[model samples]
Target: MTKDPTIAIRDCLAEIAVLHGIAAQKTLHEFRNDAVARRAAAYAIQTISEAVRRIPEDWLADFPTEPWGQIKGIGNRLRHEYFRVDDGILWEIMTTDMHALKTVREAMLARHAGAS
Candidate 1:
């Protein structure tokens, strides 16, 4: 059976949140120095971006507060240009952008849950 897109999005968001939380405790220097941590964070980000790309455009359109295009672009960049990924950009994205995305994701999940 096909999974509901809404549920898939929620799951992805939850995963992103967990990954962010795991990385949150470590300093930027730690993240930069630890290849394992960096890879884990990168994978989580790529996963979230991939899921965001799969979400229906109409549903995404409803969330004007989120940066949908940029999210998708990040996924594309990560997928296509893995070798060129910059640690500083990843740090900025994880620290700032992910929080905004998580807030939007939570709101969307809540709204969907209410509708159901």
Candidate 2:
């Protein structure tokens, strides 16, 4: 039902990565005591999860290196088990993993420049 869904997904992933990075910064601690950090982290995780979920399951077979299913699973867990969210685990994903995922998403966008 959506045109260029892949492009849309790539864009969302990039956005999530950027937002996650911003939230990950120590300066953001000023907001951490409030809802800012949690909100940003929640949005980032939701966006990533949505994008991953929209991908056809078989599409992941085309990119064996991508953690396509894992992304979807994480998103589900975060959304369904909000009470169980582990801040430390979220920090790891935001700081260590999102950067690499963002890079891959950027490459996807670049490869489909005309789509945008």
Candidate 3:
């Protein structure tokens, strides 16, 4: 059975929230120095990337500019090249990209709330 796209959206959104909680306040240097925060954020990012892959492109039509493909790559890097994952890049994504992704996700939820 196919997983529902909206559920995927929510799952990713939930993980993004987890990421923010893990590193939203810390500066880049602070975030990079903490091993636990890095791992937690990486895990959350992996989860979000998995969920992002599940969501259909048609459902995301409203947000044409979003880098859906690159977003999916995050999980691949985390899963396959685990040792090479960069903390600074992850911090940038979590701090800057996540809010935009979160906004898109919230908009997605609002856009599809009636259907579910």
Q: Which candidate comes out best when scored by TM-score?
A: 3
Decreasing lDDT order of the candidates: 3, 1, 2
CA shift of 75, model 2, Å: 1.3
The deviation in Å at residue 72 for candidate 3 is: 0.8
RMSD of each: 1.9, 3.1, 1.5
Lowest-lDDT window of 10 residues in candidate 1?
107-116
Write down the TM-score for model 3: 0.90
Models 1 onward score TM values of 0.86, 0.74, 0.90
Error of 3 at 84 (Å): 1.7
Any idea what lDDT model 1 has?
Answer: 0.77
Candidate 2 regions exceeding 4 Å error are 27-32, 56-59
Tell me which of candidates 1 and 2 scores higher on lDDT.
1
Per-residue CA lDDT of model 3 for 1-116, tens digit only, reads: 77678899889888998888877578789888888888889999999988888887788777889998888898999999989888888988888899899999999988988565
* Per-residue C-alpha lDDT of model 1 across residues 1-116, encoded as one tens digit per residue: 55566775786787677667756778888888988877777788888888887676777887977778887788778888978999878888878877778887877777676443
When 1 and 2 are scored with TM-score, the better candidate is: 1
Candidate 1: regions farther than 4 A off = 114-116
**Span of 10 residues, lowest total lDDT, candidate 2:** 26-35
> Across residues 36-109, which tens digit of lDDT does each residue of candidate 2 receive?
67767776887787876655555445467878777778878888897787766666777777877777666666
Question: Which structure is stronger by lDDT: 1 or 3?
Answer: 3
User: Model 1: how far is 73 from its true place, Å?
Assistant: 1.6
Please report the TM-score between candidate 1 and the true structure: 0.86
* Candidate 3: stretches off by over 4 Å: none
